[model samples]
Target: MKLVIVMLGLCCYSALASAGDNSKGKELFQTNCAACHGEHGEGKHGVAPRLAGDASRWSLKLFERAVLSGVDDNGRKLKLMMPHWQNGSFKGDNGNAPSKEEIAAIHQYLKHPR
Candidate 1:
């Protein structure tokens, strides 16, 4: 009985689903983002950003834009608050950005974390 139970537990743990196992992205966010972005994904009033939704607040493509180029979705002056990602703006404190493959993982993690 004890052996069976142990095996069962191991199986269940291995079977656990990882939503977009974007650990790197998640870690990165926690380190570099949690300050402005909320720990639970909730956004603050001003300081940094609220990444839950509100693409229009900046722009739908702003994430990619902000990552690659310094332009906000609206194509206005770059806000001083948002740092340029390419300029080594992201310190080593956090994990690196998600790759294309990891986007789904990151999204899954954000949408549903284990």
Candidate 2:
């Protein structure tokens, strides 16, 4: 009984840790990405591709590479308009690039935009 309880507790904790915060993601997207990606990631035609369903197929590592290194899932360079967040070239309102956790949150929000 004790072992079962401990296992259950571990599972709950793992779930909580893996879940991303969508609300915070929405706020971050609005501040940093909405300008280019649109309010709901509808995206501009010639400027940027729609992010809504496009990113759903990407793995977290691919998403991170695209955001931090301007590299696409195919390992090709993305458009010049895509900012490399890790290089500090594109600062948010807080004057800093988004952290990995924040990026994960943004991904979660993009995966299922409300």
**Candidate 1: segments with Cα more than 4 A from true spot:** 1-20, 56-61, 93-114
In order, the Cα lDDT scores of the candidates are 0.54, 0.80
TM-score of 1: 0.54
Q: Give the number of the best model, judged by TM-score.
A: 2
Model 1 C-alpha lDDT per residue in residues 1-114, reported as the tens digit of each score: 999999999887766744234576576566665677577456677665555554323432455565445575667656766665555445562546434433333333445332
Span of ten consecutive residues with least summed lDDT in model 2: 88-97
The regions of model 2 sitting more than 4 angstroms off are 1-21, 89-93
lDDT of 2 by residue, 26-84 (tens): 88777778888888777887767778799745998899889889999899998878888
Q: After superposition, how far is residue 50 of candidate 1 from its true place, in Å?
A: 1.3
TM-score of each: 0.54, 0.75
lDDT of 1 at 64: 55
Model 2, position 44: C-alpha lDDT score? 82
